[model samples]
Target: MDAVKQHQQEEYQQFIKDKIPKPNLLRNAVAAFVVGGLICDVGQFISNFGQSYFNLNKDDTSAFTAIVLVFLGALLTGLGIYDQIGRFAGAGSVVPITGFANSIVSPAMEFKREGYVLGVGAKMFIIAGPVLVYGFSSSVALGILYLLFSI
Candidate 1:
């Protein structure tokens, strides 16, 4: 076990060395922080617009934001727009519900050449299904736990 661990560590170190050279740490840090913040900023902008324009409260606004983003993601996936955005933004394109939509649809779209029954139809929900299942289950479990603890 110790030998295996040491070998793995060495391999990881070599991988890192090959991929990323020692650089200006400050510049990388600033660029990462700025880009990540910009992505979140866009998400917040959507939420705010939903709240103000749709007369939604915060909770409703967030839901509206996610739904709209997911819809846009699906549309972009259909139109092949999301791929370009993903390339440009990297984490920026992937930090929202839009990313989730893309993950689900992209696979099915790729497999569509295999025919609907065996391809798109069958595989359409493969990615999103697990996410939906876990999301709902965790929410329910948390709700129950909160209710039990509160009482």
Candidate 2:
């Protein structure tokens, strides 16, 4: 009985290994690099637009650039385009402000059919809530520490 069970387990393990798909690391890395660079390039363009056309100050230019990127990210996510990019580019599409926008919008879009109040509003923060909470909490903590140490 013990031998039979061992043989079955070995066979199952072999089957799992054979069925698992192997990733092309070089290809994935190249794709991520290209996609991530392109995203950053778009951000730079927006910043330049703000600076050159609107004559925005450095701080305002940065704020305008961030807003535009976030809007584009939300729009792409709403249109179901960001997901496709994410599938192809993996971490490339997910390490920027745009990705943060997608994180917030994606869940809201998913829950839209359920009801705006319960679904969209509540579930909207499913992924981003923890990130926001931790981010804000840490910032506050850091600010307090800085104040205490500086005094």
Candidate 3:
């Protein structure tokens, strides 16, 4: 009886495995690499533009680049293009500042119909809140440590 049950379980496992779609590992890797590289290249272009056109200093250029990238990401999300990109590039679309913007905007957009105060405002941070909390807390902790060690 036990042997029969084990055989049935193995057959079920094999049946489930066969039903699952196989992923194209090589294709996905190449797409992610290309898409991620393109996103970085766009960021570099923004940085260069800030430096050359705006004559921003190094720190300001960096800040300006981040702002522009985030804005573009949110704009694309609003326009629904980011979702398409996300589908095609998968993780590639998620390795940049734009992805962070998308993370904030996507939820807000999805919940907008529930009202501004409760829906957009509240749900807007659902995904990013924990990340922001952890990030800020760690930064503060690091800063305190640095201050203590320096003094």
Of models 1 and 3, which has the larger TM-score?
3
Task: Write model 3 residue lDDT over 30-126, tens digit each, in one string.
Answer: 8888998899999999999999999999999999999999999999999999989988887788878898899999999999999999999989999
Can you give the TM-score per candidate against the true fold? 0.64, 0.82, 0.83
Model 1's alpha-carbon lDDT is: 0.80
lDDT computed for candidate 2? 0.95
lDDT digits (tens) for residues 62-125 of candidate 1: 7887887778788998999888877666655665678788988898888899998999988887
Clashes within 3 Å, all models in order: 0, 0, 0
Q: Candidate 1: where is the Cα deviation over 4 Å?
A: 1-36
CA shift of 76, model 3, Å: 0.7
* Candidate 2 clashes between residue pairs 3 or more apart in a chain or in different chains: none
| Pairs of residues clashing in candidate 1 | none
Q: Across residues 11-113, which tens digit of lDDT does each residue of candidate 2 receive? A: 9999899688889898999999999999999999999999999999999999999999999999999899999999999889998889999999999989999
Q: What is the C-alpha lDDT of each candidate?
A: 0.80, 0.95, 0.93
Error of 2 at 65 (Å): 0.5
Off by over 4 Å in 3: 1-15, 148-151
Residue 10 displacement (Å), model 1: 9.9
**What is the overall TM-score of model 2 with all chains considered together?**
0.82
